[model samples]
Target: MSYMKEFTKGLVKENPTLVSLLGMCPTLAITITVQNALGMGAAATFVLLCSNIAISLLKKIIPSQVRLPAYIVIIAGFVTFVGMILQAFLPDIYDALGIYLPLITVNCIILGRAEMFASKNGVGASALDGLGMGLGFTLAMLAVSSVREIIGNGSWFGIKLAPDFIQPMTIFIMPAGGFFVLGCVIALVNRISDRNAPVRTGCAACPNKDGCAGCGTDSDVKEAK
Candidate 1:
């Protein structure tokens, strides 16, 4: 139950937005403003945390064949709960988030993490994993929306930074903007990862020791018995 493992897992290995690439349906659908993006992120985090813990607790009792359906039911329940609570308490955010709130049920990030990590970990670990992954997803959404909002609206979080920016790029607020932002982030991350990768020779024990350069995974040979 290492803290680093939980924190780093979502940032890279299972980044809800970029690597795992889950939950893009609403990400691209509702991120019209930073506010919407933030609201969606918070809603998602709440659902993810609850669903993960529930599933992990019931993992041993649930049958493998019915797992998918069961997971959805649990997820949909939490999604609905969050929606009702938000609508009653925070009408503004609730309205802005709109249908995207219920859309959380099908968000692959929730399902993916439930299936991959939470169901396998203990309750405490599952909770921490959900927190980390949810926060990571939220951060990524905030970042993407920030760029689009700034460039497209000439403002940050509706603050009106440049009152007269000579007409902002309206396209950045459109559907195309979402795709562009997602792609750019992916490319930037991949490029940085490649550059930071360690130089390697022909070694079997090194992570990249297998010199997977020419024929990928070549040098990734594991120790034999």
Candidate 2:
């Protein structure tokens, strides 16, 4: 695939949060406010970019048996770096994010890309994939947060937007609200993209299909027969 395709696919075609449904924990938790969303997005993006490049470069050197552990260690290092930077310069956001910030180390989006794309692609392509996925994740957070904050708190990024007569719907900022908004957004995205519910057809659609052995393919069944 072209470099452009690598960078652009994550924006919508394969959005980690919206389309693929990765990283729901942080997405739902930190999206109560736009500032939290921005901070989390930026921190996650930085970690994703750095880890993807590092993983891609070291993929050949790292043993396959231990590659998952190695990827976690690398991702954790960057997550730690991000935590320190946030604590030092943006203490408010750091505190607001709480444990969710550090939990980026285990974010499925980062690890999934590391395994599925970074470990198999060149550094340049991996970097672009990371960036695109990061942006996609960020944009998804922003979208969810904007709706929640606006409707829930009658504010956008802490600025009040609703008229005096309007009452903010507190539920939109609650855990239940987060799920509702996320489901609505995902549905909207699918509608806009003309996509139906995904169908399971063995491993053909999986990125790791080539190496995964948990499921047998038609060819494998034929061969066995």
Best by TM-score: 2
TM-score of 2: 0.91
Q: Please provide, for model 1 over 11-115, each residue's C-alpha lDDT reduced to its tens digit, 9 standing for 90 to 100.
A: 665567865567788778777788888888888988999998999999999897999899999999998898889889999988888778888898888887888
Clashing pairs in 2: none
Q: How many residue pairs clash in each candidate?
A: 1, 0
Tell me each candidate's TM-score.
0.83, 0.91
Error of 2 at 166 (Å): 2.2
lDDT of each: 0.79, 0.91
Model 1's TM-score against the true structure: 0.83
List all candidate RMSDs to the true structure.
6.4, 3.1
Q: After superposition, how far is residue 194 of candidate 2 from its true place, in Å?
A: 0.6
Off by over 4 Å in 1: 195-225
